[model samples]
Target: MSFEYYYITVVSLVIFIVALVIAIIMNSRYYKVIREYLVQARGAEAKGQAMSGEVEVLACPRCGYSTTIPFRVGDYVGKVVGETCPKDGERLVVVAIYSLRPTEYQGS
Candidate 1:
């Protein structure tokens, strides 16, 4: 082959190799970023689930006295018939625990 043809072929091959390497590098970086984002999303989802599974307490609205009553989402929370407020004579108000997902015992 002629010197000119050989030089052109070599240059073209080099260019093709460089382009392939750049493409692979870019793809690897993109995948890495995507994987990290997915991991963060999964972690956030787990945290949310754990928070939803937790039991919270309620308080007497009039007396501002807190109690460690069973908490459920969308449930009416109140004092029992014999229960009395430790802080005052005020009755307990029903307060539903808030959550993204509703709990099993979600009603009075």
Candidate 2:
């Protein structure tokens, strides 16, 4: 092969390598931004749910049917909801109030 052909082949290889490196860097940064955006979106959803208040587990004392209600203003953990259970038309009683939040792991 001629000397000029070898020189052209080396330059082409260098250009291809540089182009591949640039593409990799650009995609990595783009994907990093997307990952951060998704994380923030999930955090926002969790925050919105937390702001809605504690979860109230209600059940009919007669039929044992259960349901959940979101706690509101002036509502306490054991406050009986103003509605009755549809299963038996019995007054629904607050069974449990769950405050769901991320906490440190405590070994059981």
Q: Which candidate leads the pack in TM-score?
A: 1
What lDDT tens digits, residue by residue, belong to model 2 across residues 7-82?
9999999999999999999999999999999988985775577555666677888889986656556666566778
- Assess every candidate by TM-score: 0.48, 0.48
In model 1, the worst 10-residue window by lDDT is 74-83
Q: What is each predicted model's overall lDDT from 0 to 1?
A: 0.65, 0.76
Q: lDDT tens string, model 1, 15-101?
A: 999999999999999999999999889857755665656444556777677554334445554533234576787666655444445
Alpha-carbon shift of residue 73 in model 1 (angstroms): 23
Candidate 2, which ten residues in sequence have the lowest lDDT sum?
99-108
Report how far residue 106 has shifted in candidate 1, in Å. 13
**Deviation of model 1 at 96, angstroms:** 25
